[model samples]
Target: MNREDFWEIVERSRAEVGDTRDAASAAAVARHVVARLTALGPSTAVEFQHFYEALNEESYRWDLWAAAYLMRSGCSDDGFDYFRGWLVAQGRVVWEQAVADPDSLAAVGVDPDDDMVDCEAMVAAAGDAHATSTGDREAFWAALEQTEGDDEPAAPADPAGEDFDFDDDEQMRARLPRLAAVYRPVQ
Candidate 1:
């Protein structure tokens, strides 16, 4: 599935998730996405996995990580992974903005009091959907490999772009002035 299709699924899930975008609500979104994927059938569910991984790969950047670090006060490697999942749950507009200009995220708004900017369920949604639809997740992966070869997006050795010390307050403020103004002070 292309990004447009992926976003449609995500947004549809968000609609199911209703008005709140908090972590508590994210599980429902994942459930909705799984139901939607199951309805779409197994092949598209597998395609959704590839597209989800590609979007995650596309978003694996130092700048975005910095944004995550600031939003959550500190971000570990796995924390960033979950952050990417949450970012995906935010739908195309927020995800694209975070990738293109993470500072733009300040305008998108988040609850500073709510630090659960992680959606573990979303990370597992496609696989769960595949299993729910096909009864065996490995069978779907094998089918994908047989039909199109292994084209899963790989995680980079490190995030793309210049690395920096996220714990340094000065660097955080300078790198993400708007976000620092919003979340850093709150933290």
Candidate 2:
């Protein structure tokens, strides 16, 4: 799909999420995201990063999970490596702070029965922070620039010429009805 169409799908998906808290609704949303990503074909790490950023900004848990799953399924090694690196970095910060002063843990008041503090929550928090940052897009561009260096090599673009028109009322009318059968409106 073309960039505009892809973004339209993303936006519509986010709107569908709303304030949904039901498990089935969440699962359906996640499935839709996975379907969209799969249809998009091969995706680069940078592209996946952008998807994650957008999903996080919209507070779409399903989209984030679907993106993570897609990254794992299509790019196993890269996905695992990136996830592991994130986990390690988070662990280091938590552990270093805890060790430096045990009282830090007391502030959060860890439960004795709860063996490990929820790492997923920490990862999600970090993702949220990154998504909300005004400088995040600039940082991503800067990273890309640094990688390009002096060699201004032209990059290949997607071959599929289909354009996604998310704002098209007709398109939404056609798609939403079919989607509604599976995806109930978020209450």
Candidate 3:
């Protein structure tokens, strides 16, 4: 699937759940996405996984990591993975905006408990669908490796751009004033 198609799937899933968010909501969205991809056929489902991986790679930036860290009070390596998935689930506009400017996420209206911010289910949507389509998780990944070969988005050796201490208040305030304002980094 192309980027537009991938995003459309996300949009449809969000609509299926009325744009609600939280762990349960994220799982519901994942199920909807799986159903949609199943109807689209196996190859397309695998392609969707490719796009999802690419988008996650593109979003693996130090600045955006800082945004996730503050919004979630603190974020680990895996937490940031889920956070990127949540960002994609928000649809194209918010994803693009946050990617362009991490501070822009300060306006995304996070869930009160921030469960939506750690949406692990969103990251697994395409893979679950791929398994349903191919009837095997291993088969789905093999197909992805075959089709997406050199084109697959590889994980970055380091997050793009300068690294900084996400837990440090002064750095967060200086690097992402807007997000720091909304989340107010703990002293």
TM per candidate comes to: 0.90, 0.25, 0.90
Worst 10-residue lDDT window, candidate 1: 145-154
Worst 10 residues of 2 by lDDT: 59-68
**Model 3: per-residue Cα lDDT over 5-103, one tens digit each:** 888998888898866445566667777888998888888887888788888888989999999888877888999998887777677898899999999
Q: State the C-alpha lDDT per candidate.
A: 0.84, 0.34, 0.80
Candidate 2 structure, TM-score to reference? 0.25
Over 75-179, each residue of candidate 2 has an lDDT whose tens digit, in order, gives: 232343333222222223333343333223333332233222222322232223333343363454554344453654333232122333433435433433322
Worst 10 residues of 3 by lDDT: 109-118
How many residue pairs collide in each prediction? 0, 1, 0
Off by over 4 Å in 1: 143-154
What is candidate 1's lDDT per residue for 1-187, written digit by digit as tens? Answer: 7878989999999987775357777777888898999899888888888788788889989999999988877889888988888888888888898899999988866887778888888888888888888899787778556655465444688889989998888898899989988987745
- How good is model 3 by TM-score? 0.90
